[model samples]
Target: MNILVTGGAGFIGSHLCDLLLLQGHSITVVDNLLLGRKENISHLLNRDDFSFMKEDLLNLPVLKHIFENGRFDMVYHLAANSDIQKGSKDPGVDYDLTFNTTFNVLQCMKEYDVKKLFFASTSAIYGETCDRLTENYGPLRPVSNYGAGKLASEAFISAFSSAYHIQTWIARFPNVVGERFTHGVIYDFIHKLQANPEILTVLGNGEQIKPYLYVKDLVEGIQFICEKACERFNVYNLGSDSRTKVKEIAAMIIEEMGLDARIEYTGGDRGWVGDVPEFKYDLSKINELGWCAKHDSNASVRLAIQKALGK
Candidate 1:
């Protein structure tokens, strides 16, 4: 199968590309090098079956040309604005990066008659909910601009899939952590420690709890769901069974980096204005499909820290 991964040069996308290539599928990755780092997929650049295009999804002409010429069997739309914090600050940031990017991808897909789409949605779309999020949980009230953008994109994907007869898989991800990870709590914690080993300034009150998934577990889950959940449109919550707190993650990072830092809270329950205080996902939907996350939230954080520290 010829597969097109929109953000194939990023953390999760690159890992997915590696697995796809290993399974003898030809893969082409299109990334803008914004949040995605080229080094993430650097090893696959020399492979005959793997191709990289440093192009933004917003470029419709280039995207249309690539789609028309390549004739991709499936499209894994992994491209998006990764910085949730930034989105909280400026709503327009996510609108352009996440929502517009998906619109462009869908338009190109329609033009090229591409029928299959695998989208990367987020748990943030659930908003500041206290209940465990399910696939059917709705009237999705997203708190952050990032979440709003993703929800809008999901709606577009569903509409496009229904109208064009495209098979679509939308997986709502938790905090995904592991190798090649560019942002998030783990990444932020490590960088802060590196700069000041003695003072670890944590945002919020440090009680914000959320489920997280290891990158490998996430990719594997995606592969499994995509293979088994063959329907007109499918939505699954991809995450670990358990949850973890912000302070717990800080402690983990501090221990992993061997730093005895003074933990200082910036003072607030939420990390940012749009940040959800606490949320966990119910993975029974996917678990019923004979798939489960191998690593718990704590283990995922630990492994990501180890990889980040090069240990």
Candidate 2:
């Protein structure tokens, strides 16, 4: 199978590319290097079955050429403005990057008659809901601009699926933590400790909790769903069964580093204005499909810290 992975030079995207390449599939990556680093995919640049285009997804002409030329068997769209706090700062930037780029991809898919598209959605789309989130959880009241953009893009994809008759899969991801992570709670904590080495300044009250997933587990689960599940439009939540608090994550990082750093907290309900205080997901749907996570939240965080520290 010929696969095109947008933002394939980033952390999760690069790992996805590695998985596809190992499966004996021809992979072409398109990345602009805005947030994605070239070193992520540097090893695969010499492979005969792997190619890359250094371009943004908003470039329709370039994207169209790739679609028309590669004739991709499937597209895994993971490129977008992923920073929730940054998105809250400048929503117009988020809208253009997330919504506009998604529209461009859909247009290219329609023009080239692409068969299937797997979209990377977010758990932020659920906002602060009362009940545990399910696939059927409704109204999509996103509190953050990043979440709003993702929700809007999901709607566009659903509309395109109905109007153009394309197969689409939407996976609402929790906090995906692993190596090569450019920015996130884990990365932030590690960097801060590295810089200070004495006191770690933690954002928020550190009581906020959220679900997390290891990158390898996430990729594996997606592979299973893509191979077995067949639906014009499918939506599922991808996350680990366990949840971890912010303070717990900080302590784990401190322990992993073998440091006696003091944790200082900034009192608040959340780290940021648009951040979700607490949320948990129901992963029974994906688990019922015979795909289960090997690592719990704490174990995943420890592994990610180890990798990030090059230990």
* Among all candidates shown, the one with the greatest lDDT: 1
Pairs of residues at least 3 apart in sequence or in different chains that clash in candidate 1: none
Residue 63, model 2: lDDT of 88
Residue-level error in angstroms, candidate 2, position 209: 0.4
How does each model score on lDDT? 0.91, 0.89
Candidate 1 lDDT, 265-287, residue by residue in tens: 99989877788989988889999
lDDT per residue, candidate 2, 254-311, as tens digits? 9989999999999997999689999989888888877788888878888888889888
Please state the error at residue 99 of candidate 1 in Å.
0.7
With candidate 1 superimposed using the best TM-score fit, by how many Å does residue 140's alpha carbon deviate from the native? 1.0
Could you tell me how far off, in angstroms, the CA of residue 31 lies in candidate 2 after the best superposition? 0.5
